[model samples]
Target: MALNEQLNKFQKQQVKCQSTLSDIASSRTSVGPSRSSVPAAISQRPVATAPVRFSNDTVRLTEINNIRKSPVGSQMKRVIQLLFETRQAFTPEQINEACYVDMRANKAVFDSMRNNSKAYFDGRRFSYKATHDVKDKMQLLSLIKKYPDGIAVSDLKDAYPNVLEDLQALKASKAIWLLYSQEDIAYPNDLKCDMKIEDDFKALFRNKDVPTDMLEVEKELLKIGLKPASNTAERRAAEQMLGVPSKSKQKKKKKQEISKRTKLTNAHLPELFQNLNPSGSQN
Candidate 1:
């Protein structure tokens, strides 16, 4: 029994020593001074290189010609802007198609803008213009300057809320082309689509509880020569004062009107004379 017990203790010690030696061997293998313990070798790292990607193999022009272009030139300033505004320059037809709506609906405004925009300047190209088919921000600002009371930032945004970039550009460029915005206002209860620009603007202004900033705008507009409407009640006053009164339309042609009057007058007179006169006179 003693011999068996001694043998069992020796076996346990052997197992423990084997475990400790195995740990030491692992540590030595990881960080070794002797090359023979673990053979030294160098393997390729096989690094990941991004696949070569190539695109649009063209050089771009950064500068522009200083000499202004003719108004009718194919590459005039705004047209050039329209070209570079997006990924590609738009075709002439694209520009035309955008502005060629029923412009007669706002003939007074469209004509004024079209005629005035021609003399205005473009910020980037530093060129003068004679015509602007599109209702752009700068052009709109010029009109607002002429009629300061008639516009606002909200008015401009409502006019073209979809054109965020244009509004942002106006801000970034520090172009003062508009009346300062009053606080957004509630719509009038009795809203009408055909309200005159002045009336509509004032209605919105009043409904906003009369924002304090509006006082400055009102003063600025007055300074710039925008007149308050002589009378909001006088819809026809402008036409009347200008002697351009619109005539009421008549459905019948002048010849048809004359014929109808002649028939009526002749019908009564002929019956009376036929009863009193001879056959030859009647015929």
Candidate 2:
């Protein structure tokens, strides 16, 4: 087929698919058997795939421009391409390294992209909004539900790298949250097993009765940012707070009290001791 003919045919197919998708969406939302039944039949039909019209360079530049209108469009094009291709979350530093741009110097530009609705940033990671889909969003929500003790954001990134954007969207919409966020306490009961003492150790106390293990002792030390070995003084203080006693010290103190009582009783009975001594009686 001629190039122009192919383009026209592709455009027509694109329009048809758009109409079909709209019909499906509307039909699902509209109440009544007639509209609902139409969606089922339409859904069963094979849908036409959209043609790839844009070359790599065009697609990259177009996405960059859509995300930000500035001289850094070319630089940001590399950023956008990295995100779309990897489908993984990245920090600004990682993005800068991948895209070969100084994100530190262009912090304002990257920050703007982060704050924009087209991009998703959870303060530490970034992703393109287009990489996300509804199914992924739902799956992430289900995952959140599975771990009542909240799952780590890092774990989420590892499991659903491509859906980082969707996770952020869910967070923004209050569908999920970073576990134990004080500001948004809706997921307060979703316990997070973090190494940080305040979040993990104190959380144990908050969620359970008094801990009875040495691990709990370690957790209390961790919660207060103290090392058990190096911070012996602090560890002792924490142990005291948690009612963990030093068994050896207690035993030693008990022995010392018994010895002191014997010495005192002997001092009070000095006259009796003299009476029992033959040498004293002769003097």
Candidate 3:
């Protein structure tokens, strides 16, 4: 009787295990395939996204609205600030792009600003005009002559924004001279004293066989009691006047020559063979 009861208990436990497995299997089938059972490539596929698009007119209108929301004083101040930061002339369209200011809407403010001494408008573009006590061409010339050594073009431009026009006029009239190097330099023509070159020295220079090397030429000039331009600025100016090419150009020419000598084509073969048999006694 005891063995039969023990066998009945074992059968009941086995039946419970089978029902639990069936429930698990049914749940998996209802939920579809397990994540682990799916291929990794299909499971990790990327989803496509649509791009956001905007029209130019829409963007410009949005910018203009934002500008309109700002205070009147702030808008004007922003335009002025943009001009000062760039230190360059800008058209109405350019200003609008940079500062989002609607030139058409703020025409009255711009007109007043242009009429004022602070801003300069040349029919199309606007720029900041710095007040450096240089009002006219005479004053500009006086300022340039004040610096005996030479004044930098950048400083002059900073002092007077319309300096280039005046400089061109003055240069045409022989009132001033310009030397362009790493930094452009302006000199008053009246201050320059012309050097007197003797006929004998001129003849010497014409007749002398000077070396192509600048250093050697300098030494040769020194030996003849004549001074070559010692200052770098003077040397560059002299080279420019003589139409002499710079060292970099000279180096490029030398490299071209070397390449030509080294590069042999079919046309060069006959000449090379003839040189190899200079006596024409080859079998």
Q: Top lDDT: which candidate number? A: 3
Of 2 and 3, the candidate ranking higher by lDDT: 3
User: Highest TM-score: which candidate?
Assistant: 3
Report lDDT (Cα) of residue 206, candidate 2: 56
Cα lDDT of model 1 by residue, 21-85, tens digit: 67766875665555456434522333233343322221110011111111233333344344334
The parts of candidate 3 lying over 4 Å away from their true place are 1-61, 68-78, 81-131, 158-161, 191-283
List model 3 lDDT by residue over 57-139, tens digit each: 44445455567567766777887878766778988778877877656557666676677575789999998776555767999
Q: What's the distance in Å from true for residue 221, model 1?
A: 29
Deviating ranges (above 4 Å) for candidate 2: 1-70, 135-283
* lDDT for predicted candidate 3 compared with the true structure: 0.69
Superposition-based RMSD of candidate 3 using all C-alpha atoms, in angstroms = 26.5
lDDT of 2 by residue, 1-283 (tens): 1322444455565567678777766765664455446678676776454443433344443443343344665666677667767877888777754654445557666766776554678878887665223347677687677666566565455444556687768778766665445332223223354335555665555556566556676679899998666555577899999999677967875544432123345563243333342333342
- Candidate 3 matches the true fold with a TM-score of 0.30
